[model samples]
Target: MVAVFSEDHVSLRASMKGLFAQHSSESEVRRLMATDEGYDPVLWRQLAAGQELQGLVVPEEFGGSGYTWVELGVVLEEMGRALFCGPYFSTVVLAATCLVESADESAQKEYLPRVASGEAIGSVAFVEASGRWDEAGVTMEAKKVAAGYELTGQKFYVLDGHVADFFVVAARTSGEISLFIVDRESAGVSAHLEETLDQTRKLATVTFHDAPARLLGAENSGWSILGRVLKLAGIALAAEQVGGAQASLDMAVDYAKTRIQFGQPIGAFQAIKHMLADVMLEVESARSAMQVGLAAASGHEGLDLDEISPLVQAYCSDVFELASHQNIQVHGGMGFTWEMAPHLYFKRAKSMALFLGNSDSHREQVAKALGV
Candidate 1:
């Protein structure tokens, strides 16, 4: 693949880093985490309006920046480093990706503009109690009605569901899975907040009892659309994981250099130096893997997403989790306390490891992609 980073991309990354540094400080992250909304609307507005980040991957005709996946991946990486709390991943990565991949032009025309403008928050409701991220896991049912369709069932662990204006739901219709757009304010819709391990990211259990719905894409095509959406999600998340891992390694190295166990710094100790070196190697490897994954995702190298997606997801997920654990070990007892920021990343790494799919599942996918 060609070099993914250009002068403009470097400038954009710097701008995103500056934005997060200015707004998502540790104190700010803590303050927002305590709030019910789990994010700052003013800061979100600045990102969407001032910086136009919400539209980074959206086309210009749809009222967006018309940028490529590289830009989107970089922005997500910065967000992971800062642990910026919001509906960005839900709306921008999942929902917007579905819209972009869909063949339904009318839906794109209607919904993409709203998402681009930050006037609406969108989330995809797919996983159920089974906690499976595939088509076979969807048990929600949708029935045909006079006006439109009616859905009955529940979706668990929907990201940003409590605050979302609409949901792109996956439901079984006539023994086949289909995608539907349901308004959050509909009469039969109920959204209850879910207490997740990662409080930095909001999640909810959304139930539908004869909820009004509109079809998205084609009939029995939800699974296909979901495949593309999940691939993009994996790529974006790999970028984020690399960022988090790098930050965790940085934290450990900095602490080792300053904290003294004996006469000299702990970093001067051979054991501490070896541990930090191992973490650095893993983080850098994950970063390289993510860059290649992004290039494949952007179709820049003519590489298939099927082959690269699972590899990056599995490797990055493991790397981030390992880095977080090592960071805590390096900090000793201080890292386990709630007052420390390392715990935040530790929680996030554990939670996100299961988001799209766990490392084992992705590894399975990787093997299958390789004809194993």
Candidate 2:
């Protein structure tokens, strides 16, 4: 087989960006944001055929592109820059990761191939009504039945929940967390797709009443897998933030260079220069943090990597949020308008940070991991 990355990754990133620029325009974005689907299937298919996004993590033996988290990070960063809305995160980062972490080889064989080929869109249904992100937040129960495990209760804030072909649900079974894969249109499974604050991303509330679900791994051993999924999701989210942060910075720089004040370009003003300088610092520092965290995640499996995960998540969230806010301020009142896409990215930054655990949550995790 060919090497995973050499010039390939760079070419992949560039091609994906070219695709984004080709397909993503402000009007298309506004139309996309207003839809309940929250994504464009045509665009998604284009991505799968063009860049092979859905196969980033799936093994080559299973019909995947077989790239590491770093390559995944590169493509995702470009997507973020374009504010591309789709199931890439829901299926690849969340659901695919959940399945990959499962101990069930049969399940992987059945699901990972579909996910890799973009034949199935899988999503994680872990959060509840109150929208808690912790594993302990799961109150849904599962019971073993002759047919299959029966599930009861609901999941809220499911990213891409309404449209996913299948779902990886976290449920309490025998008083312990377990993973289950349920077809979305299966009996007794219902989802209320709702309008969300971030139009670029979709959310839903899924209710289950004796829904038939196939087991993912060893029952009662799910929290461990969920924990690993969260760590990797954090890295993916950080890479996403790096894209948003740098994009925001670029937008601000371009505006500063062209937007004129009384006599000259507003960028010549001390205030704007300092603001740009500060943004540069935040972006670079966050980039470093993300790199370190990515290293920690993909490093030697048994190596004692310590608190790198939470640190990266916390720093990345803050830096992206900062960059988004500054980008708006730099653009003046025009930035606040819907005609401008600043708010799209800014909203995305906020949602991504909060979804896979946030700055504060990751910090607390870091403390717990540190035993402080």
Which candidate achieves the best TM-score against the true structure? 1
lDDT of each: 0.90, 0.83
In candidate 1, residue 330 scores what lDDT? 93
lDDT of 1: 0.90
Candidate 1 worst ten-residue window by lDDT? 39-48
TM-score of each model, in listed order:
0.98, 0.94
Q: Give the alpha carbon lDDT tens digit for every residue of 80-175 in model 2.
A: 777777888999999998988886889998989888877889899998876677877888889899987999898888888889999999998899
Model 1, runs deviating above 4 Å: none
Backbone clashes (count) for model 1 = 0
RMSD of each: 1.1, 2.8
